[model samples]
Target: MIPDADPSADQAPALAEQAPLTERGARTRARILAAAREVFEERGYPETRVAHITRHARVAYGSFYTYFPSKEAVFLEVADLLFQTMIQLDLVPSDGYEPATLIRRANRAYYASYRRNAKMMAIIEQVATFNVAFQEMRRKHRAGAVARSAKAIERWQRAGLVDTALDAEMAARALAAMVDHSLYLWFVQGDDVPDTERLLDTLDTLTLRALGLRP
Candidate 1:
């Protein structure tokens, strides 16, 4: 004979009440998030509203509140998702690659990711200008990349692959800024696209020269 199951034992914690949303509920939440992304990309943060997102999502007016608390909440979620996607980009080169080749590969990966998310990136930048929270988010994202690059630079310096006098953190920040602003200008600011091969080559050469990897 089987013993009776304990209802209390199966009960989830109060804090995680929403953790087990049903498949249908999950789909609705995803729809709302996708709609929020679309509205933010098209109308921007200032111009977008919960109504707009709900309409685009095709859910009942009340259904939105069931998942998100407010417009800012949903927008932040969308921004977080975009940043997570970007952070997953394959920027690290494999071992045994030359420094120039590694830099080139990293640049190409960043540019490709930026191109794919250009519109959302523009929206995130715009929001970051006036939103303290978003500004912090952007700063943290950049800091993570900079920290990784600095460590890589330090390793190169230890190996006598780059200039020992170069400050790793500062150099990483500067190189990251260079790549970011270059992509921003070309993709966000509507600058004419330069020859991709030439652009990558120039950037690679400049990076290598800066690191004293090449004369």
Candidate 2:
């Protein structure tokens, strides 16, 4: 869950309910969240310190606790903000397009959103490796995406667009896995990220081919 690497630029709204933030307090909290994102991205979660956050935010060290309970709390807020932004992208292509066209368009949108948040996503994967709750959250997130794709596949199958023999749920899960892992490899792990056109075209080709659409 990450993008707009300098979150301060957007000034993400505070998470969870609390007494309304005074204008000054709101600004300070936003600063801390922005700074925390920077520090966490720079140092990774394990290496990040409250002190680092305070210094970068330029807030008094003790004031960190006034806004957040702990490093984990602040991290969660920052992560949740990115997650919200990332999911705001509706991957389900709207009506009127052919199924194959919808798939390509959806994949392109997914790639763009993922690319914007790639830096935060790498850290999310790292944290999920050991954090059970976070791991489960990741699973749930993927499951939701897979479920959406499965429904789309089922619709396409009914229209005689997709191969009927294919199990919609299983096929969707495979396709979702393909897209997710490939993005991680291309954007997060690989040194040479492909040009925008190549990146979208490659995934579009592979996904469309896998769905038994024209190559």
Candidate 3:
């Protein structure tokens, strides 16, 4: 069965789980999901309907219900797929690396990925504004990254690289917020963004400075 919203909110209504699908059934389900993503991208969430998804998939209307109970169920899976792409980018080994190099690499990776997925990212941001489940999922995803960064900072402190007196979690969250919202403004809010290399360089410098390191 496909995962609908990998990290679901407690208050969110659950979709009914389907039984294991055969190969052909799986292919059909995948087609429906792909169609749903296209519909969502073309029309945004509020304007998309189950009929639109099935019509785009070129499947009978009943085929949509056979796999997904509703448009929201399918959209949740689409959102989770987008979230997974982001998770793969930031979770990496940090040991035995220079802070400046790692910071630059991270900013470059994040900025490039955001640029590629800006359209879908914009849609997700819009969804999060009104959808509690989407909001919770976004929050949990950021929290996981912040927690990972805090662990890395703690390791840096042990090596006498970063300030030992600072609260690692708090410091990590501050840096995360700085990067996250700045990217949001440029990528989603139509703010003026510098050239790619210049933007990444500034992000790298600012992140290093925040961590009390020379850029």
Candidate 4:
């Protein structure tokens, strides 16, 4: 018979004691975030204030500060949450797919999220110009995003789909620039997005060819 497992091995009485408080903190944070989104969407980032968020959240100003230091901090947290929400949608391509297939999936993921979170997306665009801190935050976020894309391109090269000689970082940055510009154009087009599927397919072709992959 197997020896009895040690009872203390999995025991975390300290954590058990703190679990409720941790959960409550998370709930309070979520409430503030929800309130912030509404406040920002309604008043625009420049006009929105921390007091508005606290009032909307039905929490005291001190409670709001206890959870987040400032309105900008809360907005950044919203940005972080939006990024995480998109990640949970599995925008990243799987290793099993060819580069083109991966590109299609990634594009679809972006377009879908862009539509679903249009309000937050608009706020993001506004803040990128309206807030200096948000601009820096976006820069850092883009760097990380591009780094991941570069690694993915390197993986594709190893898989024999992309040219091994192409500089992964350069290709990734170019692709990021291209996708970003395209999204800007799409945003300008608004509800009149004609032939979106064709657009994404064309983007895949263009990006793949840019990476020295045959279309």
Candidate 5:
């Protein structure tokens, strides 16, 4: 005995779900973030403004604020995205591989990512000066990367691939930190050196040896 619902009302929800980002909410938020990365990279966070992001996004100013409260929020998202991407890439190594093989696979994945986004890598150099908020966000982002490495090491320990003498978590943190800092320095340093692929390969072998893994 229930009345038939209005057809037009039923159609509205479907249309809303299919609308373009300019007309939808979450899609608009993604657009803002996409624009924010380019703007932040080009001008740095302090010099960049909301107008820049909105203009780059081709969205309204109101839309920008609807998604992010300030430029800081957008910058944090950028850092978070970078960290997430790194973890996603590193974890692609399969569970069946030995710890050394997994470590090498993860290293290759990380360097491939860096090569793909060299510009964003450059932008990171400038972001540290912005404020404590940015600094804290960057730290959290790095900790996530370190955690990924730690997980792989723990897996190795569980599999009996590495010595039980060294603390896996500590070793992982040190190794991850070393790789991150070394890659950054290699990119920014002024001396002529081996290409990224070669450098990463060398590091992979060296890291395995240092971790007491055999050939």
Candidate 6:
């Protein structure tokens, strides 16, 4: 008799478990995931299937099931990986750097990452609109980033570097919304892409001024 399939395998592995994959297992998983991203980007989440991913990956159909129990599991894994990469972006200042400079650097880095993953991001947004699981995943990702930003804003306020009157959490959420919405419009909606340097400069200036930072 055939063994029963793992029930938990239908869910993406927890973050801590993701790292302990054996070398061969990791390679196979990566192949499946890369295939998933490409298929999703080209055909979108609604049209994608496990067979498409397996064919694109050039792995046996059974191999795909061994790594990811379903297309949804793999898709969530891909989104989580992308979110983790973005979360690791840093704005920490060096010894002589000013806050404004650090903010500019952070924005530049963020935009660069966004550009690299623009297609996947567009897919994520589209899927999240109607998929409850994907929507919750998106919400959790944004909330974590906003919470970090709010804490940073609070620190800046205590140091007298930011406006004392602004509510830290609200300010953080607003700024995050501004960046996310602008990127979505420009990158995902086929709006004309602005010059990189000018765009960064404008964003940095607006962010600093919003926090009541003076030149």
TM-score of each: 0.85, 0.79, 0.86, 0.80, 0.78, 0.86
Error of 6 at 194 (Å): 4.3
| lDDT tens digits by residue: candidate 1, 27-52 | 99999999999999999899998999
Model 2, span 82-137: residue lDDT tens? 76566455434345566666666677767888888888888888897787756655
Q: Which parts of model 3 are misplaced by more than 4 Å?
A: 1-18, 90-93
lDDT of 5 by residue, 47-141 (tens): 89999999999999887877677787777777667755645553432535555565666677777776666567767767776567667766765
CA displacement after TM-score superposition, residue 141 of candidate 3 (Å):
1.4
lDDT (C-alpha) at residue 20 in model 4: 39
Question: What order do candidates take by lDDT, descending?
Answer: 6, 1, 2, 3, 4, 5
lDDT of 6 by residue, 23-51 (tens): 89889989998899999999999899899
State, as a TM-score between 0 and 1, how close model 6 is to the true structure.
0.86
What is the C-alpha local distance difference test score of candidate 6? 0.76
Q: Estimate, for each residue in 1-215, the C-alpha lDDT of model 4 and write its tens digit.
A: 00001211221111112233477788887899899999888888889988899899988889987777778888987886675554333434363445566676776777677668777778788788778776776776566566667877787788787789889888877877776667666773464557888778877878877877665
lDDT of 4 at 142: 64
Ranking by TM-score: 6, 3, 1, 4, 2, 5
* Error of model 3, residue 64, in angstroms: 1.3
Instruction: List candidate 4 stretches off by more than 4 Å.
Output: 1-22, 87-93, 188-192
Show where candidate 6 strays beyond 4 Å: 1-21, 90-96
Q: Comparing candidate 4 with candidate 5, which one achieves the higher TM-score?
A: 4
How accurate locally, in lDDT, is each candidate?
A: 0.75, 0.74, 0.73, 0.69, 0.65, 0.76
Greater-lDDT candidate between 1 and 6: 6
Tell me the lDDT of candidate 5: 0.65
